[model samples]
Target: MIKKPPFVVLSKISDQIARLETEVAVASPTLANVYNDLQCQIDVVVANLEPLQTISGHIEIVERSMETILDFLSSSGDKSISAANVYSLLEPLHAKIHQQGEQLRKIV
Candidate 1:
């Protein structure tokens, strides 16, 4: 059986929550109370899902920085770029990539 991706699952769950919220507005007092409790549970699920989204974004940034660094190194040919010069050129990108990786690790 094929499983749905987490974001897709979360989106569907969010849609159902929205529908339930609408129902809550017109529900009886008892039903509305039940819906409110369910809403709190759903809120927790959504909160957990947020970290997954944040990690995905951070991974994209790390990938982009890695590509940029690769491109920079690949294009360095006859240029007598010293080690210090190369390090200086790549340090910011390296720092950004490392920061994103650290953020992802924390999220995980």
Candidate 2:
């Protein structure tokens, strides 16, 4: 049996560790850089969620207003309310309410 000098064994082990680090870095490069990239991605996600938050707030208002509209439409027989009255009331709310509704549906 033969015993190699301590430095030779230590040098081989050190080289192997360096090679492992280099191979791993081929994808991510470094731990700090990878962490920074993750933080950046999270920032983007949070920024994107801002509009959803706004819509959630707006949806509350729409839901309340819609309950009123639904009540008005639901009340009485067919001939009781005039179509003209409903049209005039709904005309201004048409575009925004529809667009907001589509966005709201996507969230739900």
Candidate 3:
């Protein structure tokens, strides 16, 4: 199966984040060399964000896979494992995504 390109979209996001960071710094602070600092921080943040987005995508795939497995388990004549375990694994992932989303919202 053909899968979507993950990093390509992320690269665009990184560029946007970098541009915003630079713009924010240049527009604010009103200090000498503030642009340099803004660029640095933007680079740091974009670097951080790219990986987080990748992780988020992976988590989504995992959740879907888990759901599929649960479906298969239910369909067959077997009930060895409970779906709760899959949900339990997803709890932390869900929380992390929510937290990151909040952080991103604050940026926008």
What Cα-based lDDT does every candidate model obtain? Answer: 0.74, 0.65, 0.63
Task: State which candidate, 2 or 3, has the greater lDDT.
Answer: 2
Clashing pairs in 1: none
Give the best candidate by lDDT.
1
The Cα RMSD of model 3 versus the native structure comes to 8.6
Instruction: Name the regions of candidate 1 deviating beyond 4 angstroms.
Output: 1-5, 17-38
Query: Which is the better candidate, 1 or 3, if ranked by TM-score?
Result: 1
Global Cα lDDT for candidate 1: 0.74
Best first by TM-score, ranked: 1, 2, 3
> Which residue pairs in model 2 clash with each other?
none
Write model 3 residue lDDT over 1-108, tens digit each, in one string.
Answer: 765555455456556656665667666745425545655665666666665566667667767866876677668665565569767766766787676677667555
Which candidate should be chosen as best, given TM-score against the real structure?
1
Model 2 vs. true fold: TM: 0.55
Prediction-by-prediction clash tally: 0, 0, 0
User: Tens-digit lDDT track for model 2 on 40-71?
Assistant: 55555555565676776776777777778878
